[model samples]
Target: MVDIKSWIFKDCCLVFSLLCISIVGITTGDQEVLTNSWLVELSEGGEAAARDIAKRAGFSYVSPVLGSDTEFHFIHNAVPKTRFRRSILHTRKLKSHPFVKRAVQQTGFVRSKRGYKPLKGVLLSDLHINNPEIGQLINDEKDVVIGKDPTDPLFDKEWFLKNRGQSGGIKGLDLNVEAAWGMGFTGKGVTTAIMDDGIDYLHEDLKYNYNSEASYDFSSNDHFPYPRYTDTWFNSHGTRCAGEIAAARDNDVCGVGVAYDSKVAGLRMLDQPFMTDLIEANAMGHMPNIIDIYSASWGPTDDGKTVDGPRNLTMRAIVKGVNEGRNGKGNIYVWASGDGGQEDDCNCDGYAASMWTISINSATNDGQTAGYDESCSSTLASTFSNGKSTIRDAGVATTDLYNNCTTTHSGTSAAAPEAAGIFALALEANRNLTWRDMQHLTVLTSKRNRLFDPYLKHFWQYNGAGLEFNHLFGYGVLDAGAMVYMANHWKPLPERFHCTAGSIKKEMNFGTNEPITLTIDTDACKGTDNEVNFLEHLQAFVTVKSSYRGNIVMHLTSPMNTTSMILSQRPNDDEHKNGFTRWPFMTTHTWAEAPRGTWTLRVENIAGKNNEYDDGLFREWTLVLHGTRDPPYHHQDADEENQTKLFKVKRMHDMAMKN
Candidate 1:
C-alpha cells in the first residue's frame, strides 16, 4: 500500500538540491570559482541550529534528510582561493562541530580492479555456433539429445546444464545445477528482479514467471519493462539475462533458468545513452520489499581506463535496500564484476569493487577466467560465461529479444543473472538469509576452480586456513549443489561487527622516488561490539594530490603477514589533473584473517611527472573493518520504519562520502 516510488523521487530531489549546493568549488568550462565546502556533523540539536550556524558564516546550508539527524552540509564561497579555504576553516571553531570531516581524493586499482590482465589467448567476437563437440558428443555418447531436453522439449542444447564437456568444455566445469535440481530445490517462491535494459515478459520461456507488480521502467517511465531493442544485437541483453534467472521449465521454448520455478521481473532503467545519480537510485530502490534479489549486470564503464562508481544518492539506496528489503531479512544484490578485462579494472569501478556487492566474475565453459572480464579482490565468486579461447562464439543459451532464443549471450553480463538464479534457489531453501549471510554462504561454499588455470601460481593466496583465494578467480566458481546445501543448513551469523583505525589527520610528504608507509593499531577490535575476528571487507579512505595520478600505487598489509594489492598503477589514466578525492579502495583479501594488531597502508609515488609542486600531501587515511562478533549486539530493525518514510543514512552516509 505504501507508495515507495514517490518516496524515492522525493529523496532524489532532495539529493539534487544538496549536490547543487554542496558542489561549491567545482568549476565549469566558462567559470572561475573560489569556494570551499565542508560536511559538518552536529554534536547536538536540529537543522535550524545548523542553518543558523551556516548563516553566521555567511554560507548556504542544505540538509537532505536521508535518514540521519546529526549531519548537515554547508558551503562558503569567496575570491582569492586562499580566502575561500580560510573562510571555510572558520567553521571548525563552531561550538556544535563534533567531527569536521574533509573529503579525500584517491585513485589507482589492483590488477583485478584494473581489468588489465587478459586470458592467454582469447578473441572478442561472440561465436553463434553450437558446441564444436556437440555433434561428436551426440554420436559418441548417443545419450546426448540434439534439440531439447527429453522432459522439456525445447531445452536440449543448454550445454552449460546438460553436459559441460559435450562441446569440449571441461567435464563437470558447469555450476552443477542438475545435481541441485535432483535435490528438489527448483527455486520456487523466490523472486528476482533484473535491473537491466528490459525483459521480454511475453517470451514463452519467461512470461509464466514474470511478476509485473514488482517491475518498472525508469528509462521510459512505465511499469512495463519490455524490450525495445529493434535492430541491434545488444537489445537482447536484458531478456537473455532474465531467461537465465526465471525462464519457465517444461513449458519452455528455450533452456530453463537456473531457478526455473523462481519468479522474475524486469525493472528496466538503462535504456538511455546517459544516466544521472537519481535515475540509478530510483532503479535500485524500486519496490525494495517485493523484490527478493536484484540482479544488476551493469556498472560504471569497464573500459579499464575509468575510475568511478555510484555517487552518494545511489549508494544510500543500496544501503537502504540491504538494511530494509525482504521484510528486514535483507535483499540479495548480485552484480557483474565487469567485462573490461582487456582495458580496465573492476576495482576502479566502485559498484563491482564495493564490499557491499557480491561481485560475480565470469568463468568460461572450459573453466578459465574470461578474457574480457575484470578481475578484483572484491569478487566473491564466479559463474559460467562464453569460453573465449577454443569456443569463441559459444555463449549461454537463453531467451532473446522478439520472444526469440539465442546461444550467443555472454560476458560477466550473463554470468551475474545465472548467479542470481542460483541465489533464488538459495533463498527458497532458506528465506531467512540476510545479505551478509548470503555472502558468507557464497564464500564458504564456492569451490576452487581447479581447471586448467595458468595463473594459479601467481594468483593463489592461502587465507592461512587452507582456503585459497586470488583476485583473478575470487573463491573460484559457484557450486550450486554446495551453495544450496549450505544455504539450507546455514545457521545465521552474529550481528555485523566493525572497527576503525587511524582517524587522526596527518600530512605525509612524497618525493618523486620514495615510498611511504602509515601504520595504525587495530587494538580497538579486541572484544567490543566492534571486534573483528575474521574480516569480510576492508576499506581505505584516502586523499591525494598529483599531476599524473596514474603514476601512484598503494598497498595494505594485515597483522597476519598478508599483503593486499589494493592499488595497481594505471597508465591510461593520465588525463586526470586530480588525484583521489575521498575515493575508497576496497579489498576482500582479508578473508578469514583476524584484526587485532597493527595494519599498514603503504603509498609509493612510482612515476609522477612532478613532486616539485610538493603541495601534494598524503593527507590522511582511515581503515575500516567489517567482520563479525559473538552474541551479536542487541539487534534492532532501525531501518524498518524507513520503508514508510524517509530513512536517515545514519553512520553509513557520513562515512560513505567525504564527510
Candidate 2:
C-alpha cells in the first residue's frame, strides 16, 4: 500500500535508505518490480506468443520491446527465473532454453541449415524497475536550479506544481515546474489563442494579461471573447483554460498558471452550436503571427464512437498556420487529447490526432492515469489533471465566469491549456522555435513512462531515433523545467516532407469470421521532393458502411511491425452510423521509422454480428507519410527546426509504392 517511489527520496535527495530498501527488497525477497528485470529478445513471437513464452519461462510479461512482434521482453518476478518466482540479483545470465526464435518475418530472413540460429543478446543495466521516467541519460550542461516558491497564500494547495502527498496527491509527481519557475520563465511575452467557447477576461486572475487584439468571439461578432453564460454554467470552460495558461501570479484570486506571465487571447466558437469547416479554419488561423499558440479544449464528441476531423478548409488552414505562421516560424497548436475514458481512442478525433497539433492528455494528482483517459500512438505528452474519482479532489482551480474562481476544472480540457501555458514559457525562453522545434522539445524533455501510472502497456519503447514511448502515457508526463531548459538552447528542425500511397476502394463483409488486412507498398515515397526516410505522422483515410459501428476494431501496422490501435470497438457506440467516412486516422507510432516495404492495415468486425448491413464497404483507402529524409537518401540536416532549409528531399529508399 506504500508508494515505493516516496521511500526513494529523503531529505531532498535519493538517499541510501530508499536505495537500500529497493536493493534489499530485490536481493532478499520476491519483490515483483525489482526481481522482474530481464532483457529478452524472441526469435519469433507476437504479444500473445510472448505472453505464453513468459508464462512458460516463469516470468511476468510487461510488454514487447517497443511493440516488436519479433522480440519478447518480460520481467523475472521470482528468483533465478523459476516458474512464477523469478530473481535478478541471484542470477547474472538468463537461460532462454525454451524461449528461442518465435519471430515470424513477413519478407522472411535467412534460415539456418543446422536447425540452430545464433541467438543475439544484450543487457540494459541501468533501467529502473518499471519506471522509465525516473530520468534519462541526458548530457545537460545547464544547472537545474529551482526558483523560490511563489508567494501566493494558497500556493501550497496547488499540488500540481509542488506535491507532497496533499489530498491523495503524489509528491514530486506534478508537472516538474519548480525548476522552470526558478529560471524566471513565467511566459513573459508569448500569447496563447483559446479556440473554445469563451473566456472571463474581467476575472481578477486573468484580466490584465488578456490580449484584446488577438481575442475574438466567433460565435458572436464581439471584439472581446468574454464568457457569456446565463444558462450553461460550465460555459466558463474557456476562461478556466485561459486561467490555467495565464492566470495572475502574486496577486492571485485563484491559483497561478503554468505560464503566469503569459498573455491569453480567447477565440470563442464552440458556443455557436453549429460550426462549419470555414468557421473552424478561421478559428485555427485567427491571428497567425499574433497568436503564438492555439489552445483548444474541445474536439469531436468523446462518446467513444464519433469519428470526426476537420473538413477541407480547416485542414488547409491548419497546414497554413503551421507553415506560414509566426513569420514563417510555424504557429503552434495545443489540443486536448479527449476525455473519452478507456473505451475511446484519440485516433477517432481528427483534431487531437492531427499531425500539426500537439495532442495533450491528462494525468492525475495521485500520479495515476485519469479514469477518463483515452489512448493513441499520436499522444505526445500528458499533464496533471483531475482524477475521475468523486471521492477525491484532483480537479484544477482556475477563474470562473461571474468574476468568481472555481477549483473544479478537470479532464483533458484543462490539460491542454496547461501545456499551452508551459509551451508559452518555453517559447519565451526561445523565440525562434518552429512548430517542429516545439515537438522535438516535447519528445526530448517530456518525461517518459513513469511506473507510477501502472497502466502502461510497455515500460519503454525506442523510436527510430531511440526515443522512449509508452502506450498509455505516450512519451511521458510534461517536464516544464526540462522543456524550458531545452527550449533555451533548442535548434531548428528540417523542413516538412510528404509522401503518399495509392487510394484503393475496398469493401468488407460484415459476416466474415476472419480479420482482413489491406497491404500497400511505398515505392512512390522515393520522389524528388516527397521522399521520406523516417516518419512523423502516418494518416489513413477510410470509408465504410456499417450497421453497428462499434463492432469494428481496426489496427494499422507499419513495416517495422509497430501496431497502432487506430479504432477500437467502442461498446457505447452502438448506433448505426456511416463508419469511417473518409475519416483520417493518424498515428505517431512510426516516428523516426523508415517508410518502406509493405505496410499492412488490419480491419475486423469483432462482434461478427450476422445482421442486416453486416457487410461493409471500404469505399476507398489512402495513406500519407510525413517525415524527414533519413541518411543515405539525401544530405541530412541535424537542425530539426530550421525551416529556412527546406531539406534535401532526396529518396532514402526506392518507395516502390503499391508493388
List lDDT for all candidates, in order.
0.64, 0.65
Clash count list over all predictions: 29, 32
User: How far is 539's C-alpha from truth in model 1 (Å)?
Assistant: 1.1
- By lDDT, who's the top model here? 2
* Alpha-carbon RMSD to native, per candidate: 12.5, 25.5
Question: Can you give the TM-score per candidate against the true fold?
Answer: 0.73, 0.71
Candidate 1, run of 10 with poorest lDDT: 104-113
Residue 355 in model 2: lDDT: 76
Error of 1 at 594 (Å): 1.0
lDDT string, candidate 2, 1-659, tens digits: 11123222222232221111110001111333222344455555457766776676666665443224655445454442223333432232334445454321111011001101122111112111221112222223345442345554445556777776776776677786766776668899899998877888887778899999998875565687776665546466787778888888777366688899899998987764334443576688777889999988777667675655665446656767877788788889998888887777877677788878999888887767787778776788888777444644456766667666655677788788889988998898889988887886776567753424566543556554445666667777888877887678664555566666656676546443356778987763675666776677787766664566666777888776777777776666664545666666777766666777777888776663344335455666677777766432233232232222213122222332222
What tens-digit string does per-residue lDDT give for candidate 1 at 571-654? 555534556655667887776556657888888766643433223468767677777644221221211212121122112222
TM accuracy, model 1: 0.73
